[model samples]
Target: MSKKVAVLVAGSWGTALASVLAANELDVVMWTRSEEQATEINTQHTNTRYLPGAELSPRIRATSDMEAAVADAAAVLIVAPSSAMRAVTHQFKPFYTPDMLIIHATKGFETESLKRMSTVISEELECEEGQIVVLSGPSHAEEVVKRCPTTVVVASLDKTSAEAVQGLFMNAYFRVYTNRDMLGVELAGAFKNIIALGAGMSDGLQFGDNAKAALLTRGLAEITRIGVEMGANPLTFSGLAGIGDLVVTATSQHSRNWRAGSMLGQGQKLDDVLQSMGMVVEGIRTTQAAYFISQKYGVQMPIADQLYHVLFQNRQPRDAVEALMGRDPKTEMEVMKLETWEQWHS
Candidate 1:
């Protein structure tokens, strides 16, 4: 029997991953809320709204029924937007079985609970948190569907589960790596979008490579600082889910967060920019969550703080940039203190 995988929510990333599994000759079933979308994927094999101009594999099928998608599946990969993750997982709970491997490709936290996607899924499923694996990295759905060479990481507290997910998604065009730093992987992946938004704002404001480069650099520091304080392995931030994801999201036109930030930088109002995008820009909400997270942890995230003011408080984008540049003199490695480095190495 061919391996079967269920992808929840037929969004761009979900569809792209379904295609990869289909390529591996797995029986792939995708669940969507929209009957129209399910019909399109089932009949036309195309997801025009999320992944326009891309032909999905015929081996991939779509359905609107939750039981139909998850029934007897070898693995269930939840790719719902973070905002919808809890509800979606709750819907799948009735059908979820302990024997089925659970993985999530969703990034970002529950705005209400400030919990990671894996944590949210675990809570809903009533399972050990370690059982849920996170698939993340620099691979954008746009590039992945095109079979552009992409590398990603799947991480879990359970090594066997992580490796299982890695094997299921690995292919010639798409490479997968395994990591045990589940917390760091999730944290880095979510936190990097905040930086990417800042990067886009920098570009939109006509700041050159120097400014953008500095943002990416210090942005990593800010996220790493918080991640470390939150019990994440600092080295994981240097890995794919960390720096790798951060670089692509911050620089690529494919990044919705970056594009949204660019518009904000160009003086567009938050409501206006979101209206133009027509897609969920994770960074906007994430910036809000990160604001409270930084305060709760007592971590100084200068870039995220500036973004919060710019996006929410009507602080001008240029002023945010100026504030970042005009901060009091400090050592470059303040966030990555010597003790933290030693702790990581030890």
Candidate 2:
């Protein structure tokens, strides 16, 4: 018999992953926080609220009981939003075992402690670093659930574990790459959303493609800066987790950060935009956390700082852009310092 795969959370990303696992003939059980979503997935085989018109596989079971979902599962994938990740991990603490492969599909960090989702999972679940894996990239739940062509990276400090996750998720249309730099993967995943928020602000300001292009390039610099400082491989940022994810997220109309940024750019209130998203826009909280981390680590993250003001300080998006543009110009790599090959290794 195929291994039972327990996918936690019923959000769009969670449902989409459950669909993928079920299609691969794994016995998939999805734990939803809402009974309505559970009923929809189990009875209707649809996640109408999040991914409208997408059909989920009937093999995927839905439940609210944490223990029932994780029991006897071969692998457990945590797909809850970053904000809820801590609570979700606590709920699963009783069932956690070292033998089960744990994969976190969340892409952001905790706002309070600025802890990465996988970090929070490892600490809360009482597992070692090698026991956790992060699967991230340009994957949009709306597209992946529909089997649209997509690619992502499965990263862990343990190469074997990363490969294990890569093998399970890889298919013809959805390709998976493996990386050993868990720190880089998570940082890229969390920081790209900050850039997407900036991109959304530019779009909201009715700025042309040129402005958006500059933001993306500079944002990559900002992302790489903090990532390398935090002991991540600099090259990882240039891969699927970095530029690839940033391109898809910042430009895609489906991105929640972009949508929220657009509203902010148009002078709308943060609360109103957030209320409309319904689901947590990971970038909003991440912006604050990353902003704090950047300052604490002395990493130059102008984009994150600007977005933090826009989201938290009620700064006008247009004014924030002007402030960035008005800053002193310097060599591009001045902040990144990724010039010499030895600097990367050191």
Candidate 3:
């Protein structure tokens, strides 16, 4: 019998992954709250609203019934948005077993609690936090659906679980790498969206490549700073989940965070931009969380600070740019001299 994999909440990324599993000869079942979406996937084999112009494999199926979706499934992937992570995991409480491999591909922190997706999953599912695998990197749903070459990193303290997920998702077009620094991987994945949004605003303002180059470099430093303060390996910030994800997100047209920021730069109101996006711009929520996190950690995240003001304080994007350029001069290695850096190494 073929192994069954259950995917929660069939969004663009989830559906794209479902296609990958189906192509690999696994029986894929997607659970959606909307019966209409479930019917569309089961009968039409396409989620036109999310991933248009692509056909799904016959091995893929959809169900609105949560229990049925997970029944006998070897693995259950939780791809719910950060805001929905808790409620969605609670839905799994009735069905989850100790042996079911749990994986999450969601990026961004829980806005209210500022918790990583893995932490929230473990909390709701009553499992050890180390057991949940986090799948992240530069892969975008739009490109992955077209069979584009993509690579991602999966991290877990449980080495065997990470290897199992890597085996489950790796294929000719999709490659998976394993990283032991799960904290860094999750931190990088969540933090990059903020930089990507900043990058989009820069481009939208027509600030050119020089500004973007500087933003990305400094943005990475702060991400690493906060990650290190939170007990992550600094080297992980240089890996695929860090630099690789940041570059792709900040530069790609496929990034919703970037798109939202671009619209903001182009003079659109937040409500208007979000309405037009028809999707959750995770970075918008993430920025608020980042603001609180930086304060708590005593980490100086200048770019994130500026973005938080521009996003929530209604400070003009142009003013944010000016503030950044006008900052007092400091050595480039100042990032290495933080108290957290010294303490972390000590």
Rank the candidate models, highest lDDT first. Answer: 1, 3, 2
Q: Which stretches of candidate 2 lie over 4 Å from their true place?
A: 338-341
TM-score of candidate 1 on Cα atoms, chains taken together: 0.98
Provide the global lDDT of candidate 3 against the true structure: 0.92
lDDT of 2 by residue, 134-198 (tens): 99998888988889998999999898888888878888778999998899999999999999999
RMSD value for candidate 1: 1.0
Poorest 10 consecutive residues of model 2 by lDDT? 333-342
Q: Which of 1 and 2 is ahead in TM-score?
A: 1
lDDT of each: 0.93, 0.88, 0.92
Report the C-alpha lDDT of model 3 over 306-343, residue by residue, as the tens digit.
99999899999999999989999988886654665666
lDDT of 1 by residue, 57-169 (tens): 98899999999999999899999989999999999999999999999998799988889899899999999999999999998899899999999999999999999989899
Off-target runs (Cα >4 Å) in candidate 1 are none
Q: At residue 72, what lDDT does model 2 achieve?
A: 92
CA deviation > 4 Å runs, candidate 3: 337-346
